[model samples]
Target: MVRESLKILLTSCFLLLFLASCTLGGGKNGKLLKSTGQPYEVVLEGDTDSIVTKILTEEVPALPQPEPLCRLIQVKKGKIHGSYLLVRTRIVVNIPAAEFSVGLSRNENASPQTVIRISARSPQQLREKLNPEKLRQLVDEAELEHLASIISTNPSKQNREMQQLVKKNFGISMNIPAEMQASKKAKNFIWISNNASSGMKNLILMKMKEVKSEKRAEEVNSEERRVKKTDAFSAQEKQQIDSMLRTNMPGETDSMYMVIPVLAKRGLWEMKGDAMGGPYVMQRIRRGKTGDEIIIIGFVYAPEMKKKILIKQLEAAISTIK
Candidate 1:
């Protein structure tokens, strides 16, 4: 367990620093500003039932995204700008040395946003969690001083080709990082079927995973129905939920905590672990979606002194998953 914590600490160090979709800059060749040669405004509105997919092709990857956690959903068209009446499911996966999130955005200033953002964070939380006293014993002020830059920076960026799609879900973009190399890219985001997992990691990912039109529509309908119910905690109970949201500094994430949609049913409260040097704390906050009878799933980890800074990074990480 102690040795595992050390590896997690190193992972936290690498991933949190690779912030995606939130950073900025692209000098030439759209190097920093990923530009795809595709048209910007997609006006097709009839039955807009289409699929979106993303695949990865890389060797010796630093981290691997969990399969089930990554998925697609078609959002209502009008919710986002210049989007077809359809949207895809959005998800983010955190792997050692990588803080990754993917999705489409609607209100973003840019159009056609099928992008990827990665970031890095402090490993202080990991060491503190693994062995607070031992960490203190093994490392002195000199080592602590070297970690200054890694903790203060955010490194989000834009993936040019899929910007249209990404913008519809994630709503924002970042400048690509100069430090990391392009691991790989897929010709089409949606290509393979459910059985695609038979191939090696990169092969499976590089070829987008496909879902049948009927099944995709069914999932979307089920999702909508889930969100259509209109009941919530009583007036007094909501006050309590509000009370929790108002407080909670959540030392490890961004300032945008507990912002559930005002009119949806079945609100979600989430906070997940940072996989620091030790077990991460669970951060929980509950709020109902104004009127949808939807079952919400969340990922919130509690706050702990060991992972003071690292928790915030992971918090920021999951916050991007909507």
Candidate 2:
């Protein structure tokens, strides 16, 4: 009986030590593991059919068609213990609490990770506190930063020659992808394109004289100056942009030119005499208080492919402009 008791005690002690080592070792390994997930992907921890999920998965506005801002991988809260903790981006919602709160943390379990936690006492409070636009903006910003980081780190993937040409011509630097080449260059305009057979990805850089009207000046300097969609531009501004595009982005024939239609959704660009068209993202930045304004436009012409990701990649590349 004494020997049996001693044997049992030893077994229990061994099991305890083994479990303790596993706990410690697992934590350390998790920290060492690099974050994993596709770009623009977020692991959402909540009921798949909950309001939180629906709000998060809503289509992003201003696109040609319906497209979610972030690719969501929904998982229940109880199942988010192991590999899910290592996702590059995560959103945890519907957490029960006495008071509502939202918090964000980075690199908690793996390098380059973002975890957002939202807690509320009831669904109504959650709905009130959760702003779909703001949530989409937050995720979009994070994804852009991640993509920019990847592009900046991989110098070999960048088009050094085209980047140098841009810097020389426009006095600005951009991380043009290696696949793209300079298709056209002028005094104040430069066009870069991959010219792929499947589809074309193009970037246009142009310098424009700033409109000096007081109200226009204020709007230009205001935070609202950041162009989010084609609808943000006034009729006059759209006319001016169309004129510029006609002079710069021309097609094969004399009558063919690019124009942003008055009723275009999400900055859609159409070729006047050609059937080719796609989504475009444009941003205008004033170089200095009295310097020429810079307009960067990234557009895709992939009729045979899904364009959201292609446009996203171009957007990421454009975000690297300095």
Candidate 3:
């Protein structure tokens, strides 16, 4: 009896140490192992029904422009990998057996240690409990979180000269990538670009005079302006923006100019004289009533490359305007 008890105790102690090692052995450089899915993509594990699939993959129409909230949010079917197993910012949906829950956890294995998890009993329950709008919002939040991580890694990678120019002229500080160079700096305007051999990414910052209206503009005491209106996605605003681009963005000669083909969404620009074109996002930001309004434009001129990532990068940079 004594021998048997001793044997059991030894086995239990060994098992505890083994489990602890397994839990702790997986990280490097204080970062979780890199996740498996591509950037903006999620690997979904478990059985999904038509409703769940539609909810996960459907394009979000509510955005100023209709585009798949999940277009960049690619999803694949598989069990959650060990790398992203503990990631706190995750969307995890189990089958009929589990209950709904949302909480945080530390994934010792992924680059992002925190994970956001969503748990539900089943696809039907998930759909029944969450509306389409909420679903889209969750996905948007996740993507923004991922984008923020990218920005945090290199917050000051932008050119110092352009930074100074923007601060001096616009009184705004921008977070730009070091890969970009200051291309144009005019009165109350600044343009920066990464003029790579094959493709180019551009950022434009311009200040607009606010006309006095019935509602006096609120005075903002901040050094930088805040993005006030998100109405640029409207057709009328797009037309106005198109007009602005035609007048402000010049081509090499008088006959050549940039034009927006579609005013419904982020407009596409093409040089009349040249074969250059890409996608662009434009926004008008304000600093309450007393401060001037500013227009920030982020565009990509990558003809042969994928514009989604580049455009997203521009969007991320422009979003930094405080």
Candidate 4:
């Protein structure tokens, strides 16, 4: 008997069919229970004699409020279309069933770097039903933050770094190695690898993550000032810009489109293609007539990312992004 137990795991932000397992029951004495020929709910009506043993044997995490389920999955008898947010990473996940919904909040009390806060209670239910061990391998904010922490957020007073020294401007700090390269091109700031480290839980050092491409003078969502200026990029120059957006970003990377009002209006895409995955990363940059451009930063993970945790973790990481 095939019981409809749909397991939809929401690891990070990406959605994959992780154990879309259909639990089944009935057929005692090799006989069907009902011939309604429709999906019917199964209720277990039995004595509670073994309640104490079952409870004792059941797996209950010693986490504070179930650890926010690094992954959130919702499986109805079939599939329930919905959107769930990975609060810590801020990735908004939407399935075919629902319009875009963006109501996700991180648990200030969670205090776990890798934790993902799911918005809907359904996802919470999904999280509760699934096995916990299945989630350990996926990358989560806790891991990324752990990786980010290994790097020195403070920049060394070194001169002539590949990346112009960003004077700790963004109040938010990251674990960038003092030796890791840095550059500040215009309003945007970038950091790259100078040394590789194994313990780096985040993808930064693994060469799995990097600035796939950076766009300048191009406008995204806004029209460029059409002043009588010959310095405007030519058509062929524009194709080079268009080609940038040919592929989807790896699931691990986030596409950040920034609008710098005073200095320079621009959009930036960061792509990290982990070699473990099919490819490195693809940064898709496109152009708009009004000087606007769209940057798609993709992190294509190994099919392993398709796992609930990686998808949700990447989704969570992407969600935290603007």
Candidate 5:
């Protein structure tokens, strides 16, 4: 069954590539590509109860907290096209009638385009034969590719000076836009934001001393253990974030402050006394052997703007951590 599925997927991808190449004009094909639609917005083209839909929309509870997979990615479901035949396009998922086939295709039309094709003889067959965990992983992998492609198509010049500043101050190396400047800086915290009239894209970096324990040190750092540690640390991180935001990230008024919702790894934040808010995602990673941990927070503050794309841009920029 797996072999058959692979065959179908490969053939479809090849056919789409051929058709796209034949149809597109030369200069237009090589033109600077700009990512369209909101970030993490998926063009789902499948039955409402299809396995692909079910897996992509599943609630992910394994994090230090629980949130829907779509929420974590800030995925907004686009208009349904309901056809797998439209593979010669950008980030799209096509669900065809076949027997368990799934594959990702690139360069189908534009320079940095992607198409995820999933098929099965029936939805029931797909559910029976598929591993939900693997399917969830596939979505995440595709999301990274989609993000990278967007950045590639719309390249941002590296702000070397800002990079140096961050390294000197925060002891971290990551890419930031040349125009983005640090609005706030502290011994262990920095807030960098881009100057966009429509909306603001911001990134916060906070480093703290990880508490040392004999049991924690002795625990094998496997993937499972790492997840457990993150789950435990998530609460602590949230408290720290709340305190930081209250002190550093002041709102329009003194009464307004940022608060992390209970048992949430991501949520919308609103200024208490002001009518301003947007989405946010927080993640924690162990930095070094010196018992230091890094807490990365990316947020959006576009009152009347769609935030998924900007939040995604912030995520992509931060992902450049080497």
Candidate 6:
């Protein structure tokens, strides 16, 4: 009887341990549930009135219209157990602790997940110590990671041939989607586009020699500007960029060309002598150790649809620069 009792206790313990391990691993199947929600969407929990929500939902500066940096769905702490656990990104605030602190965890309950938790002895301390910019940076990094994962996992969605061509010409790797066909290619320039009827997404790549004068001008402009640091362009900088765009990105007609309008808002691009205009993002990066610079511009022509998400997706594609 003593031996039988010992055997039963051992069996129960083993079973309990196995069940606990399975739960921690996400489920009995030993697989994590795929994260849910659209890109840049985040599930926010805990104190709603805190700066966390404000920063997450704040309008992105210098855009043509109001658009939040992240789409947020609020939830109470008790409600974060089931499907909420599968959200791609989450932020929790005001948890009780000895002192103010912030913590981050990845893939805790689901794959491709980012969970940020803020703790403090009191709500006041949490608010006082929290750095809004730091929180924003964390959220941005999480969203970018989520975007990169999406692009990397789905080979069918990416245009490998175009990416390879970019590598051959510029010696840089970029993940271009299969939907964007190479519309035009020239000496050190390539134009790729989706060519959709409802809306179109375009990307331009150009390799140019780095000029010391341009670098000095940028530094001078930076020192002279009294406004807060933003992506907005100075008048002289706008003219220089516009000239470069016109020389490379010409329109169908001889008289028409691409230009950044004087009244153009940040990230806006328009075609001269034409009615076509949309949002654009441009980045100039040094090409390896060479003196050449690679110019990447992503633009969208979606007049009818909301452009916030579309521009962000384009940004993600551009970010694949390696």
TM-score of each: 0.17, 0.81, 0.70, 0.24, 0.64, 0.79
Root-mean-square deviation of Cα positions for candidate 2 versus the true structure, in angstroms? 6.4
Residue-wise lDDT of candidate 3 within 1-322, one digit each (tens)? 9999999999999998766655632545343345445545654444355454466567543122334445323234455555456443455455564687655455545545444455677766777675666655665565655665565566566567776777888777667777887477666666788878666888877776555444434435433444456343445445555566666677988777777675432566677777878778766666674457677777788666666666767777666665
- Count clashing pairs, candidate 4: 46
lDDT of each: 0.27, 0.76, 0.61, 0.27, 0.60, 0.75
Model 2 regions lying over 4 Å from their true place? 1-31, 214-240, 262-266
Give lDDT tens digits, candidate 2, residues 51-163.
76676678765566787667778887767877777788889876577898878887776767887888887777788887767777777787777877777889888999999
Task: Give the winner by lDDT: 2 or 3.
Answer: 2
Looking at model 1, report the run of 10 residues with the lowest lDDT sum.
Answer: 199-208
The sequence of per-residue lDDT tens digits that candidate 5 reaches over residues 249-304 is 78777998766564244556666677777777666666434456777777777766
Clashes of each: 88, 0, 21, 46, 3, 0
Question: Looking at candidate 6, what is the lDDT of residue 35?
Answer: 81
Q: After superposing candidate 1, which stretches have Cα over 4 Å from the reference?
A: 1-178, 189-209, 213-217, 222-322
Runs of candidate 3 exceeding 4 Å displacement: 1-37, 50-53, 59-81, 84-89, 97-116, 216-244, 260-276
- Prediction 3 global C-alpha lDDT: 0.61
Can you write out model 1's per-residue Cα lDDT over 1-322, one digit (the tens) per residue? Answer: 9999999999987776564432333222222332222111122211131211122111111112222112233334334332222212111221233432222333222222222212223233222223323322222221222222132243333224433333332232322222222232223221111121122011001111222256434544563443222233344434443334324312266544433323122122333323322222122222122221111121222222222232223333223322
The digit string of per-residue lDDT tens for model 4 on 178-207 reads 443422232222324332232111211111
**Residue 46: error of model 4 in Å?**
25
Full ranking by lDDT:
2, 6, 3, 5, 1, 4
